[model samples]
Every structure is written in C-alpha cells, then in structure tokens.
Target chain A: MSKNLVEFNNISKFFGSVIALKDVTMHIKKGQIMCLLGDNGAGKSTLIKTLSGVHKPTRGEIIVEGKKTIFDSPRDALDLGIATVYQDLALVSLMSVTRNFFMGREPMKGFGPFKTFDVEKANNIASERMGQIGIDVRDPSQAVGTMSGGERQCLAISRAIYFGAKVLILDEPTSALGVHQASVVLKYIVKAATSGLGVILITHNVHHAYPVGNSFTILNRGKSMGTFEKKDLSREKLLGMMAGGEELDKLEVELKEIDRTLKN
Target chain B: MSVKSKSIQNKSKDERLRKVSRLKVLLNRPELGALGGSILVFIFFGIVAGDTGMFSAYGTINFLEVSANLGIIAVAAALLMIGGEFDLSVGSMIGFAGICIAIPAIYWGWPLWCSILFAFSMAVLVGYTNGILVVRTGLPSFIVTLAMLFILRGATLALTRLITGRTQVPGLRVLIENDPIAWIFSADAFKGLFSWLGSLGIIALRQDGTPLATGVPASVLWWIGMTIFATWLLMKTRYGNWIFASGGDKLGARNVGVPVGRVKISLFIGTAVAATIYACVQVLDAGSADTMRGFLKELEAIVAAVVGGCLLTGGYGSAIGAAFGALIFGTVSMGIYYTDVDTDWFKVFLGGMMLIAVIFNNYIRRRVTENK
Candidate 1:
C-alpha cells in the first residue's frame, strides 16, 4: 500500500464552549486524491485549519510518514512538505505573477547586505512552471488581478507543485468558480494526484469530486459520517449520504405535495 | 503526425495572442502617473514663470531645495503607507527630536554627536511604540498615530517651555559651528560647482559681486541617496515583496509566512528615524529648535506620497513616484512666487493637484487591473 502522507488520528478541536470539530479521522495517501465532502457549517474549515497548522487540535495527534508530529506554524507545516491553497489562494492581486509565485520563498543573489531578489531566475521559473500547468502567461510581470479566475487557480496550483509539495490541501478551490472553471480545476487535481502527491480536496459538490477522488470522507455538523473507498460507494449512495438520507426523502415528499397543490 | 503539427501551431498562436506590448507594461508601472504629472507640472510652471528666472540655475536650485526637504520625509512616508499604515506623528516627531538634540547640546553641555544619538534613540522608541500599539491592539494606525501626533506636539511645547521658559531654543549652530559632524549634516558639498558657474556668469551673483550662496546642500544629496536606496529596497529585495504583500492583503500575506506584523513595525521605526534625520538637518542649518518647527509636515508628506501614486488604501506605490511628487510640489509652490500669482493661491493649487493626481491614479489602476 502507498504510504500515508498525513493521517489525523481522531483529532478534536474546541473553541471556548463550542466544538468546531469532533473526533475526525481522515488520511490522504501518496498518489491518491481524498475528497473531503461536507455541507456548509460541517466543520470542514476547522478540520483543515488543524491540518494546515493554523490551529492546534485540542486532542489527538497528527501522524505524518508513520510518525506523530506537531506543527507550530504554517511555516513548520510547509517545511514538512505540506502546502494548503485556501479558497482565496493567498495571492496579492496587485502584485505580478512572478512576485506572487515566489512571495515568501523568493530566490536571492549577491552577498550579505548587498543581497537582492533574483528577478531573472524568478521570472523564468514562474513562466516555465505556469506553462507546464497549461497557463500561457504572456508576461510574468503582468499583475495577477488581470488573470481569469480559472487562470489564477491554475497559478496557485502550479505554484504549489513547483515548491515540491508532498501533500496538497485545496480548501474549496472551486467553490467560487464557474462550471467551466471548476472543471478546469478538477483536471488539475487529477494531474496533481497523477504526479505522485497526496491531495485533500475539500468541496460540497459530489460531481466535481466523483470524477477525481480516489476516496471519500463525508462530514456532517462537526462529526464524520463515514469514510468510503471508490469501489465501496456508488455515486447515488454518496450523494444520498451527503444530503442525509432520511431528511432528503422527507424533503422530496414535501416538495411533491407542494407541486400537487399548485397543480390543483 | 498531422495532429501533432496542428497542435504545435496552435500553441505558438496562443503565445502570440498573450504577448503584451512594451508600452502597455510601462504604462502599468505604479509610478507612471506620478512621472507624467511631474512632467506636466514642470512644463506649466516653466511656461508661466520662465522669464522670471524659474528656468534659471538659481530658480531650479530654489525649488530643488524645497523639494529635497519634503522628499526625504515623503519617501519614508510612502514606504510606510505601502506597508499598510500611517504615521501622523512624523511632523511632531520632527519638533520633538529637534528639542531632544538642542536641549541636551546647548543646555546640558552634551557633545553634538551625543545629543544627535540621544534624539535618534527617542525617535526609534516613539516609532516602536506606535508600531506595537497598532499591531497588538489591532487598532487602526491612523488613530494611534493621530494620538501620538497630539501627544508629541503638546510634549514638545511643554518640555521646551519647562527647560528654557520659552518656545524656541537657539545657539545650536553656534555651539557646533566648527564641528566636523555639523559639516556632514548641514554643509554644502558642491560649493566649487556653484562658484565655478558664478565665475562663468551662468549663475547670479550677490550684491557684493561674489557668488550668491550656491552649492548642493547635503540634505539634497541625502534625499537622492535615500530615494535610490528606497527604490532598490522596494524593487530588488525580498523584504520589498513582503511590504507589498502585507499592504495588499495582510491575512493573505500571513498565511503565506510573510511576517506581516514585523514588516509593519519595522516600517514605523523607519519613518520615525527618517523624521529624526530631517529634524537634525533642519536644526543644524537654522541653529535652533522651535515647538512649531515642523507643523503640518505630516500632511504635506502624505499628500506628496498620494500625488506620487501611492494608494491611500496601501499595497500600491513606488519611492521614485513620491520623489517626483515632491518635485511637483516644490516647483508649484515656489514657481507661483515667480509667476506674480498671489502666494495664497498656492494652497488652492496644491488641493487641485492632489485631486487630479488621485483621479488619474485611480484610472490607471483600473486600466492595469482590468486589462485583458
């Protein structure tokens, strides 16, 4: 079996008197895309924050490469080869593509106090990597705000891949995109998985996840509903589970009664 | 084989489609609007006051001197604004620092150098306090520094009066008249150049038939050096990227490990130190410190920065742009005197210029960001 890049061992997070996440155990393996499915307020954000080292879990441990580890900051998690691309993409729109590509980890040249950003090196790498991801950025100096929504997503994804991310966590990357842009992002997710990196795709849409997800874990109101393999769960069953089977059935009956009353 | 050739052709076509014109890129620079405005202002003044020696070497020097004084503070203010904060206390800090130097050197009998060092330390402390309060309490820097402005101003008046029973402190230049350090800060380095021009009759002469006071002021050199340093720091250094990111989107920058809070704090310190430097130069040249020495300087610096194309909202600006903004201000303020216009109209001109520059900057930003 492929090695587990990162595994959460029953992690629970609490804020004051509220439980943000409770006993959530999910793991992403190498070369596999794990779809973390949840509706709004399903504790997806809290779980991801724990995973990305934004917040520490109140209980339980995070196991990485078969050993437990504690991350003090997002920098620590990044050093461990874990990269999270939030829905906002953490990009400065006013800045250039090259600038955004190497915002924190800029290449340097010269010595001591004379050291400066290696602009040529940064520009070349940014343009080359973006091209590899099918984004034909004309000038690396162009402000990122000028790019299309899908193209910006591509830039963020390509940036992660270039930085040698072993595990990539995408937090609702497609939630704000259109149907076509979302599909383009899904294609990149498949590409990232094929490149031998572990990917956690957090999303509310099952159709977007079904085509790319190797495994699925559903969360409902701070609790894990179930974890299922692609072979074990059919598309209809996964959708039914996500919508809460009993509630969805009642909802459908009520909708039908309303329709019959309107016809009368 | 046919499909492969077609795909290659399509890829090259896409590349061609994405190629932007060089002019478009140049126009997209943050400083472009400021540069154009400076040129236009220069031309307008040149035409209106050209016959009155506005284009003469003397008049050029006059405006340049005025610009240098404001440019020094404006550049630092521009950087702080770019880093996503404001320092309204810079004007009052100048007065305070001046007193810090003058009181120790003249009254306490401290050496000039020691007094200067003491003033610098005070400046840094005040700057650090401003930064910490803003960062720790999550307060808007505008309000924090606004409070600091009043505090520093009131303290300058109260302390100066307490020490000397007066608002003005004199004898700074006399005390350090022959000191080597004074020469470095306040002396003209290019005396030979102006004297040579005077001899050649290229520049005006004094009534005594000697060359009028004409040499490159040390402050001017400092202004140029600081502008260059700031430009290089913003354009060529890793910290420059952090400044842009911090101002552009603080939370976004923090998520990517940009140390946004530290960057902002350092910027505050930087602005304070720049104000201190300005105060030292001004005091050494004038030979005194007054409680009202640098009134409204903070507003002028901010206006210069805004005219230079720095976004009042932060995250977008350039040091070179601010420098040009100062140049425009100096030319207009002094050029009005040469053109027979009432000096009172200068304030009106300043206001109109700022509004026009802001509107132009907004238009350029929209064009750059919305361009396909």
Candidate 2:
C-alpha cells in the first residue's frame, strides 16, 4: 500500500451556531484516488474548503506529509504543492490557453532589465502538457473561452499537473459534464493518480466514485457515516448506508399508508 | 477518434475564424467592425473633400501629428480600461504636466531635458497618489479620478496665477525662437536620423550636404516606438495576462496569486506617463502651456480608445486598436478642416463616431458569442 500523504484528524466546521462538519477524520494515501461522498449539505463543501485552505476548521489538525501545517491562504496551500481545481477553474476565458497555463508564473527569457515572458517556452509547454493528458487541442494559442466545458476542465487539470501539484483537489469536476465527458475527465483523474499525484475526488455520485476510488468516506448530516477502504466495504453496504436504507424504506411505507387513508 | 470533431464554423466574411482562439477572436474581432466604420467615414470624407488637398502631404502630416498625440493618451487609457478602471484626471493631468514643464523651462530657465524630466516625474507622482487612493480605499476609480481631476485643475489655475501673474501662461515663445533642443522636440530636424528610419534603408543624399528627405518629427517617431512597445507588452507578456485576469475578475485573479493591486497602480502610472509625454511636446511646440488646454483631452482619449474597440466594462482591448482609433480621429479632424465644413461642428462628428463604434462593437460581441 502507498504511504499516507494527507490526514485530517477530528476536524469540525461551524457557521454561527450550525455545525457543517463534525468529528471527521480521513487519510489519503499517496498515488491513491480517494472519493469523498455526501448528499446535499452533508459537509462535502465544508470539508473540501478546509482542505483547500478556503476555511479554517473549528477543531483539529490537518497533517500533510506527516507535518501539521497551517495554511493562512490558498496561495500558501498552492506553494506547498496542494492545487485545488475550483469548480469554475478561475480561468480568464479571453486569455490564450498558454497564457492561462502560466497565468501568474510565466517563464522569463532575458536577464535583468531586458526580462520578458518566454512566449516560445510557454506555448511549447502548454501544448505538451495538454497532449500528455490526452487532450488533443490542436493549438495552445486558442482562447480558453473557445474550448468546450469538458475541455476547459481538462485544461485546468493538465495545468495543475504541469505546475507540479503533489495533491490535486477537484471540486465536483464532473458535476456539469455529460456521461461520456465525465468518463473522459475521470480517465484524466485516474491518469493523474497513476502519474504520482494523490487526488481527492469530491463528489456526491457514488457511481462515479465506485470504479476509480480506492478509498471512500461517506458523510451524513455533518457526521461521518463511515470511512472505508475498497476492500472493507461492499457495494450493497455502501448504498444502504448512503440512503439510510431501512429507515428510509419505513418512511416511504408510512407515506403510502397516509395516502391510502386520505383516498378512503 | 475523439468523440468531438464537430467544429462550429462561422460563415461570416472570413471562414478561417473558426480555427481562431478566443483571445485572437476578441482581439481581431473589434478590428473588422471598426474597419468597416472607418471605410464608410473615409468614403464620405473622400467625396466631400475630394478636390481639395485632403490627400496632400501637409494635410496628412497635420492629421498624423494630431493622431500621434491623441493616440498616446488613448493607448494609456486603453490599458487602464482593459484593467477595469477609468481615470477622468488624465485631461487635467495633461494641463498639470504641461504647466510643470513650462514652469521649470520658462520660469526657472532650466534646460529642456531637465524641465521635461521634472514634469514627467511629477506626473508619475500624481499617478501614484491616484492609484493608491483608489486601490487602498476601495473607492470607485471614477470618483477617485474625478476628484483628482478637479484638484489638479484647481491647483494648475492657482499655480499659474501665482507664477505668471496671469491665468494663461504664454507659450514657450522664448525657447522656440532660441532653443535648438526645443526645435528638435517640436519642429522637424532637417536632413537627420528620422528620415533614414522612415525611409527604411533608402538613403537620400543631396549636393548641399542635405538629405533628399527630411527627418520625421521626433513626436511621430516617439509615437510609433511607444505603440510597438505597448503592443508587445500587452500581447506577449505574463503581466499582460494578469492585467486581463484582474480586469475580468479581480477576486478570481487574487485567489490565483496575482498581485491585482500592483497591476492597477502600474496602469495609472502608464496613463500619467503618456499624458506627460503629450504635454511636453505640446508645450514645446506652442512655447506656452495653455491654462485651458487639455480641458477635455481625457474624454477624447477615452472616446478614442472605446472607438478603437476597447470595452468600457473592461478586460478586453488592444493597443493597436487604440492607435487605429486615434488615427480615425486625426483624419476626421483634418478632413473637416479641409472641406468647407464648420470646424465647430467637429464635436457632433466625434459624438456620432463614438456612438456608431459602440453599436458596432456590441454587434460584433453578440455575433461572436451567439454560438456559445
């Protein structure tokens, strides 16, 4: 098994008096695809926000590579090689693909006063990285806006990889994609993990996570229902826990009874 | 085969647009609509002023000179606009900077270079103040720069009265007549470096040690160089990307580690520098800083930028477009003068041109996005 890369220990988050996450603990191993599953308002966003440096946990420590690191800003997380591919991807649609790839950190050619963007290098790297991710974008000079939604997500993923992100946090990357497009993005996610990135896939779809995820953490009402490795949890058991199987079935039966009485 | 080979082909004028990237699409997008309007204007002017010297070298020179001056300011304003801000103070900045040059050169009897440098530095200083106030205070740039406009104009009036004992400072009449340096800056230097550069490798020699072609005006050369530099900076640099990103979405840019504050401040400085350049040349040529000069120069500059294809909403524009827009203005001004048109009616023409350009810009924007 791969060594653990990041671990959240008893982390909790609150908004005023309401609890968002409670006593949640999980560990992501290096080169592993870990899917974090939850329903609406089940703390998926809250957890990812804490992980991506968007919010500070009300309780507990986040240990990365065995070091308990405190991140004050998203930039701090990024500098430590933790790249979060936000849902919207934070891309300037009118900028070129190459320009977006090296938005804030463009390579420079000349030294000192004559320093300028290394345009040739940027164009080459952008093309090569896109190709590496199996995204056959014909030209790096194309504007990012011209690309389709799936292509844009792929570009952002490829960009993070190019920037040497050690751990990639994707925030619902496939939420807006079609079935085939989602598969394509999933393929890239798997490729990223295989290529040595510890990827955290944040999604609500159990089916999307089933094939690629090596470990899963299910959250319900701000509390962890279970954190299980692939071998530890059966597909049926996972589904049952996800829907609170017996209780939800009973509730449905009760609703049916109520409808029958009203009709009578 | 990758499942998505379906390309959206735009059946517009040129078919190759389908293969163009978003940035190029946005950059070249404005050019087409703007060029169309320019052609219409050209045809109209050509018919009305055909027999007159509308195409004469002297007339062309005058138009070009005006274009160069206005183009510098427009280019600077375009940069600021693309970064999602406006500076109403640019007009007053012109007056202020011009006065700075005149005061040192005329009153203190400083050398032309020294006085110009002093004035340029003061312009940059004012720019720094404007930028800091807007960015740090989170105030609307419109209000901040508008306030600056009034303050600078008032200061200029007060300073002129205190120094010259008159509202209007006389043109640098003394320097134009006596100073050869001033002549080099304003009047064309004969048989020298500029003609060579403009000739593009063809040398002109005469019997009297004079060149067959005279050097182009220094201001013209300066304008060309600045345009080239600005273009290179905008399209071919990392900072350029940051500018677009910051202007498009400031929060997103900041989240991604871009220094939004610094870029904005730099933009203000660029605008001020451009204004100072224009003021220096204008004062040198007229020999006195006009108190009421550059009164609406800022608006004209902004209008030129907008007509050239800059989006007032920010995050989209081109340096070349601004230059072209300035050219259109210069041509119209000269064309109006040459034709028997009332010169006072020029404002109406400018307003109409701006309205037309804006509408055309909107049309192109819609057409470009209709597919998505």
Candidate 3:
C-alpha cells in the first residue's frame, strides 16, 4: 500500500448544540490530491480546521504515520508539517512579500545572542520559491497588498510547500479568483500534489475539483456521502453526489408545485 | 521527481500586476511624505530666517537640542504605533521618571547612577503594566495609556510636593559633575573636533579660542543613535517583521504564530524606556526636576509621528520619518523667533503641517493601493 501521511479516523466535531461534523473518516496518501466537495454549510471548513489544529475533534483520534496524535493549536500542526492556507488568506497586506513569506518562520543569521534576520537570504528564497510557481516577484520588498488575489494565493501555497508541508490544506483557494486566475491556482494545486505532498483541496466548484482531484470526498449537512476514487465515480456522478442529487430532485419538484399554486 | 519543485518558464514581468510607474513606486515609500515636508519647512525657514543666524552652527545646535528631546520619544512612539499601541503616558513619564531619579539622588543621598537605574526600572514596570492591561483586558491602549498619563502626572506633582515641599528640585549641578555616568546624558560630545574647527578658523571663536558652538549635545547623539537603532530594528530583524505583522493584522499574525501580545508589550516598554531616557537627559542638564516639565509633550510626540508618515491606525510607518517630523517642529518653533513671528503661531503651524502631512499620506496610499 502507498504510505498514508495522515488519516482522519472517524472524526466528529460538535459546536454546543450544533453538529458541525459527524463521523468523517478519510486518509490522505503522500503524493495524492484529496478534493473535498461541499456546499455552503457542509462542514468542509470544520473538517479542515480539525486537521489544521484550529479545532480539536470532539470524538475520534487522528493518526499520522501510524501513530495517534493530537494538536492544541495551529502552530502545533505547522510543527508537524501540516499547513493550511485559509480562505481569508491570512496575510498582512501592508507588509512586504518577503516578510509575509516568512512571517512566523524567519531565517536568522549571526551567532549566539547577536542573531539577526537574514534579509538577503530571505529575499532570495522568497523570490525563488515564488518563481518556481511562475510568480515573477520584481521586488520581494514590495507590499503584499499590491499583488493580485491569485498571486497572493500562490505565495501562501508556495510558502507552505517551501517550509516542507507533509499535508497542504487549502480552503476554497479558487472561489474568489477570476477565470485566468483560477486556472493559475489550479496549476499550483496540481503542481503541489505532483510534488509528493498530500493535498486537501476544499472547493464547491466541481469542474475545478474534478480535473485535478485524485479522489473526492463529498460532505452534505455535516454527514459524509463516502469518499470515491476518480475511476470508480464519473465526473457527472461525482457532481450529482456532491450536490446531493436526491435533495436537488426534491427541491425541483417542490419549486414546481409552488409555481403552479402561484399561477392558479 | 514529485518531491521537487518545477523550474520557472516565464521570465517576464508578472501579467497580473499592472505596469506601475516609477513615480508610483516613489510615492509608495512611507518616509517620502515626511522627508518632503521636512525639506519644505527647512527651505521656508532658510528664506525667512537666513540672516537671523538660524542656519549657523550655534543657532542650528540650539534648535537641534529641542528636536533631539522630542525625536527620542517620537522614534519610540513610531515603534509602538507600528506594533499597534499607544503610550499617552510618555510625556508624564518624563516628569515622573525625573522626579523618581531626583528624589533618590538628592534627597535620599543615593548615587546618581543608582537613582537613574531605579527610574528606568520603574518605567519598565509601568510600560509592562500598560502592555499587560491592553492585551489581557482587550481595552483600547489609548484609554489605558491616557489614564496612565493622568495618574503619572498627578503622582509626580503630589510626590514632589510631599517630599521636598516644592515643585522643583534645583541646584544639583555639582553632584551631576561629580557623577561618573552623568556625562552620557548631560555633557556635550566632539569638543576636540569643535576646538580643531575653531583653530582652523572654520568656525567663530571666543576670546579663549573655544568655538561659539562647543560641540554636539549628548541629546542630539542619543536622538541620532536611537533613530538609527529603531530603523534597523524595524527593517532587519525577526522582531521587526513581527511588529509589522502584529500591527497589520492581529488575527492573521497570531494565526501564523507571531507572538502579537509579546511584541506589543516590548514596544510599550520601549516607549517608556525612551521616556525615561528623555527625563534623564533633561534632569541632568537642568540640574533639577520640575513637576511642570513635559506637559502636553505627548501630543507633540504623536504629532511628530503622524507628520513623519506613521499611520494613526498603525501597521505602516518609519522612524526616519518621525525624526524628520520632529526636525520640522523644532525648526518651526525656533525659527519663528528668528523670523519675528510670535511663538504662539508655532502651534498653528504645527496643526496645519500635521493636517497637510495626513492629507498627503492618505492621497499617496490611495494612489498606490488603487491597483488593488
């Protein structure tokens, strides 16, 4: 069997009286893309938050490389090579690209008590990393606010990859992007997955997900509709299951009845 | 191969970024506005007060002494503001800290250095307390530091009155002269250089062959040194990045594992310590501590920071800019005397210049970020 980098073993999370996630079980192998398909409130965020250590699972344990592990904060997850590029992008716009690239993890030079941030080294690494992803950073000292949304997304993803992320989770990376920009980000996803890092790509766009996803996991109203391999499920079937085909059918009939009543 | 990064194919400018003009890049600098403003002020003063000897070595040093006093606090203000907090108590800290040193050195008969050390420690405690209150209670630092300002001012007045039965502690010049470390705060530097210049006839000399201007004041050196250190701290260190991040976006920075609270606390301490340094220089030079000293200097320091191009909202600013802002202030306040303008108009000029600086900064930010 291929080595599983991380396994979400029957994780469930509840927010007081609300069941945000229920009995979700999935595993990500090294070098595979696990696309998470869900609607607006389908617990995709909650599930990823659990994996990224923003929230702990109310029930069940997480196994990483065959050992049960727990995470208290996002930093803990980062320490174990789990990095999440949140939907909001978590960047300080006023800061420079190099500073944002190494916000938490800055490279230091000098010995003992006289250590300093290595600006030359940081600028080189940041620009190089972004270049690998096709972002020609003219100046690493330019403020992040000046960059396009797509470039910012690429910066975040590339930063995670550069810092040695074993598992990269991107929450709705392409939702706010334009057509060309979306394609740019999609390439980064494929690029990341092919680079041997296990990726959990969260998106509602079936078209964006189907092209790059190795397998798909569908979430509906806090319940999992099972994970499916690309070959086992056709693109049409995957979209149908992701949008909960039966629920859509029921809504269509109900809407038609309302239309007839209004006409009468 | 999947584990490795792919090579870049596109060697052109990023298509997503609009072709920004060189002018736009120049406008993007935080210090540009302040630097421009400082130049304009200097030119205006040069034209109006040229024959008044305002630009001469002696007159220049006089205004510089005033500028240095405020620049020290303003540079520290810029840092704290960048770290996303305010220290309104900075002005009151000067008065309180001086008294703290003066009471012990003169009244209790302690060593001057020991008293100076005591004052700095107290400043640390005050700064740390302010930081703790702001972070732990999640209150606005403006309000917390404002209360601190009043409390410190009132305490300084009350304590000075109770201890010595007077508002001023005077006549400590002999003691200061005797003290080993007082020269760091009180004495002028570069005396030999000035004497050499006098001998070379490059500068005006007195009957004893001493230059009209003896040397650079210790305060000026402190101002320049502190500003340089602050600029370096902001631009070249991990802590500098964290300060920008912490002020830029609290949650975003915290999510990325930046210790926002600790960074802000250290910044608060910086301002307090800067205030203590200001107090030491003044008290040592004057050979006295007065309760009325440093009144309303907080507003002046903020004005300097704001004029220097630090955003009132935090996250964006420069220490060099703040230093220039103080330069403009000192020049205008002192230059008015040489130009036959009432010193009262200094406040008017200060307000008008602050308004202009703020407008310029806002316009530049809008123009640059318009691409977004």
Best by DockQ: 1
Predicted candidate 1 versus true structure: per-residue lDDT over B1-372, tens digit per residue: 456434434544573565456697788777887799888888888688778888787778779888888898999999999998999999999999999999999899998988989999999999999999999999999999999999999999999999999999998877777675767678887788888888889888888766775787888888899899999999999999999999988988888889998899999998899899889889998999999978999999998999998998888999999998888888888888887778999989899988988998888778767765
Taken over the whole model, the C-alpha lDDT of each candidate is: 0.88, 0.80, 0.89
Candidate 1 — which residues are off by over 4 angstroms? A256-264, B1-19, B207-209
**Top candidate, metric TM-score:** 1
lDDT of 3 by residue, B127-244 (tens): 9999999999999999999999999999999999999999999866778867888889988999999889889998788898789999999999999999999998888888988998
Candidates 1 onward: DockQ, in order? 0.72, 0.27, 0.51
TM-score of chain B of each: 0.94, 0.84, 0.94
lDDT minimum window of 10 residues, candidate 3 chain B: B1-10
**Candidate 2 docking band:** acceptable
lDDT of candidate model 1 versus the reference: 0.88
Instruction: Please tell me which predicted candidate would have the highest lDDT against the true structure.
Output: 3
Identify the superior model by TM-score, candidate 2 or candidate 3. Answer: 3
Clashes of each: 0, 8, 1
Sort every candidate by lDDT, greatest first.
Answer: 3, 1, 2
Report how far off residue B295 is in candidate 2 (Å): 1.9
